[model samples]
Target: MIEIMRTMVSYLGSDHKHTALSGGDHLTCEREQGAKRHVQCSNTPGGRIEQLEPCIDGWHCVMNFMILIWQKLHKDSQEDYGTLSSLFARIGCSKAKKPKNDMHTCQAAFLKVFKGHIVTAGCKEFDIEGHKEVNQSLLSSVAQTVVKEFTVIPEALLGESVIDSGDKVHGYARVLCHFASLVLLFVDAWKEGDGERVIRLWKILMLHFHAEKKTKYALEALRLQFQLATLQPYLSHQLTWGRFINTHGGLGRNIPCDLHNEHINKLYKNIISNMGANFTKTASTWAARSVSSLHRISMAFDSPWPLTSRLTSTVKQQLTARGQMRRTSRQL
Candidate 1:
């Protein structure tokens, strides 16, 4: 990345020289100096916004740190519960394949069966398939979609937090969802440069975190709070992170999430899982399918992707028949 930036700035320098010879406007010498400084030691930033953005986003900051907390917490919980439940056992999940008992397969078949996700639990949704590292895009979407949806109160349920703490299933789900929401909000505030808002969210969740003081998550939360408290004085004066950009030159809009180029990752994983060792002619096959999918989306997305679709009529009938068969077998 440093090399790329060096090449880019060098090219920009040559371009600037040409513009100056042609009597065109050019970057000031100070701007050139700042760009060079930005590419230097990323950790010891020159405090310029140009230097700050790449510096902040280049290394793992709040986003990476918080994700590590969530990933470990989520994984540890999953290990105790063991394998994911069968799709047919999950109420609203797709009913397509036989008892292979695979969550990934169920997710894939869901597109065909219901034209949507086969997710039974909203708050528990995670990316990275539990085998890989926590994915940044997954974390991004979870905060926006999953956490947002879970936290928003319905009009009828407004002003009520009636989830029974004693109830095993719903109680646990509620706590997980609420905590996830807190983390995401803190993350969003930091990313958007709302320092006061970040501190406010931390304060709101402070009591709840204290209540769970025995947990590792609470320790992580407190550690984060301490870091934020130290920054409170600076944040009060600085206000938005954009101010840093205006005054300095470092903190830009790039995140070193590292998943920016992984379309082939998905393709290879899918082909290997679905095709196994029989990969002869499979490369061209999936590639053609990929192109065909692109063409369909370009010309006839509405046909392929309806605005609304329910469980297919045939799948519904099959479910009913299977229910009847189970009943008869139980009776016999």
Candidate 2:
């Protein structure tokens, strides 16, 4: 998803074309400004602005949601700042500091609070003996973990609607929670390869998304919805062939290509970084080849038969534990 968005951004350059009015002093100023700014403008009866809207991927979708959550929390804090501060303090998020415009801080802070909530609720609801902790290693997908955990947030923690509307009842936080839960349900259906359920959930989610247009993050929400809509056909295609191609005699699950690509990119960058800051392309290529050859030699020496089995078993264990955690979370 990140790769796709980057490609689109590269394709569409920084300055987009726009139309402006003509036959006036404003037209002269517009032309002058266009020439000065190195932007193209045309005279047309009706003005058109070429706006580029990038598709929001899962990572960005969650990040934007976190931003909205943070904004709403702070807005509500104006009424009872101490209450909000204390609530987050319980999760080790001291000092309700305003996050920067980047939204990374917002995501990290909210994720910490959400993870804490999930751990506390899970321990109590599952009646686990001893001091058990959630296996953080199992949560490889931040978006999935966030949406899944959000479904079970205690109602007491979701404060009342700070927006004083005579017609509306539910607050933005509650609505957003429902939306995230719907997304998680949709993902679950997709994982199960239930096409009908996936379609149904998609429709329901679209309806809810349209209803959320009145919220503060309406444009961001719309972008997320558009991204989901655009990916539906691609997701359907994956669902169709995923099981057959990904499994060996119906043994394994389909790995997400986006995550796989991200992992590979990270590995490549790590390798490049290890070779110092100023390595040529040819040198980097040789370095990668050398590493590959060394890995193959090591595998040959260490017996290749156990390697595959070991990886498969490790993956299976992790998947099993993750599934158990999800089931427990749903039950909670």
Listed per candidate, the RMSD to the true structure in angstroms reads 16.9, 14.4
lDDT of 2 by residue, 47-78 (tens): 12222222212322333344444554554342
TM values, all candidates: 0.28, 0.36
Give, for candidate 1, the lowest lDDT window spanning 10 residues. 18-27
Question: lDDT of each model, Cα atoms only?
Answer: 0.37, 0.41
- Regions of model 1 farther than 4 Å from truth: 1-158, 161-167, 214-235, 239-332
Q: List the residue pairs that clash in candidate 2.
A: none
Q: How much is 137 displaced in model 1, in angstroms?
A: 28
